[model samples]
Target: MQYNYNISRITLNDDSHQLIGEILFPTINNDIVLLEHVFINPTFEQQGFGSLLVAEFVKHAIHQKLTVKLLDPFAKLEFAKHPEYQQLLINE
Candidate 1:
C-alpha cells in the first residue's frame, strides 16, 4: 500500500540552501508528522544541528498540535531493551 505524505527539505542559510534534513507528514492525516530521515555531514555531526532540526520540527508540531513519530533503527532494539524508550513506545 502506498501512503500519502509530503516531504520537505530543510536548507541552510548560506548562499546555497544545502540540504540538511527532511520532514515527512501524512497528507491525508495532519495529526501526525513523521521524522523520516535526518542526517548531517559527518564533519557537522555532534554539534547539536540534528537536535536543533528536531527541536524546530517539534516546535512546529506543537504549534500545529500534531503528534510526532520517529523511526530510529538503532533505537528500536535499544528502546525495547530500555525502560525510558519502552515507556515512550507505550505512550506512542
Candidate 2:
C-alpha cells in the first residue's frame, strides 16, 4: 500500500484533518534533529506508517543537513535495515 504523509514538526493529519500519526524531530541546535518520538494511531499500526515517518525524517534531514539522534526503538530498527538512512544517524 502507498501512503503519503506530511513530515511536519507540528503534526500529520488525515483526509478528515484529524491527526493519524506524527514524527517528532526536535532540534537541539542547528545541525542535529532528535527523533524523540513517533506516534501512530493504534488502528494504523503495522500498516507501515512508522517506516514512512522515518523515511520522511531522513529526507528532511538530508535537506537540512542535519544528523539524527534517534530515541525510538522502532525508528532504530527501521534505520538498521536501510544503510542509506543509517548514515544520517548520530553515532553517539
Candidate 3:
C-alpha cells in the first residue's frame, strides 16, 4: 500500500507544530550529524513510514556531506531490512 508520509525534524527548542514523528539529530558539528533518535507514533508503526524517515535522513546526511552517527536500535533494524542502506551502518 502507498502511504503519504510527512516527517519533520525538531531541534532542541522549536515547538510550533504538531509532531506525528521525529528523528533527532541534536548535535551537528564538524560536518557530522548525530542521528540519535527516531520515533513514530505507535498507531503509525508497521506502515513503512519509519523506513521512509530513516532513509530520508540518510539522504539528507549524504547530500550535506555529513557523517551520520546513528544511536538508535530501531534505526539500525530498519536499515537492516533495506539492503541498499547496509553500507551506511555507522556502528559497523
Please rank every candidate by lDDT, starting with the best: 2, 3, 1
Q: Encode model 3's per-residue lDDT on 1-90: one tens digit a residue.
A: 222222325321114433446677655567666677888767566776677778777776666665666778988687668777655545
Q: How well is each residue in 1-92 modelled by candidate 2, as lDDT tens digits?
A: 33343443635566776666778778876788788888888877888777877787788788878888888888888888999997887777
lDDT of 1 at 31: 62
lDDT of 3: 0.62
90 in model 3: Cα distance from truth in Å?
A: 4.9
RMSD of 3: 6.2
Off by over 4 Å in 2: 1-10
Write down the worst ten-residue block by lDDT for model 1. Answer: 1-10
Residue ranges of candidate 1 with Cα displaced over 4 Å? 1-9, 12-16, 23-28, 73-92
Residue 69 shift from truth in candidate 2, angstroms: 0.9
Count of residue pairs whose backbone atoms collide, per candidate? 0, 0, 0
| Candidate number with the higher lDDT (2 or 3) | 2
TM values, all candidates:
0.53, 0.82, 0.65
TM-score: model 1 vs. ground truth: 0.53
Give the whole-model CA lDDT for all candidates, comma-separated: 0.45, 0.76, 0.62
Residue 12 CA displacement from its true place in model 3, Å: 17
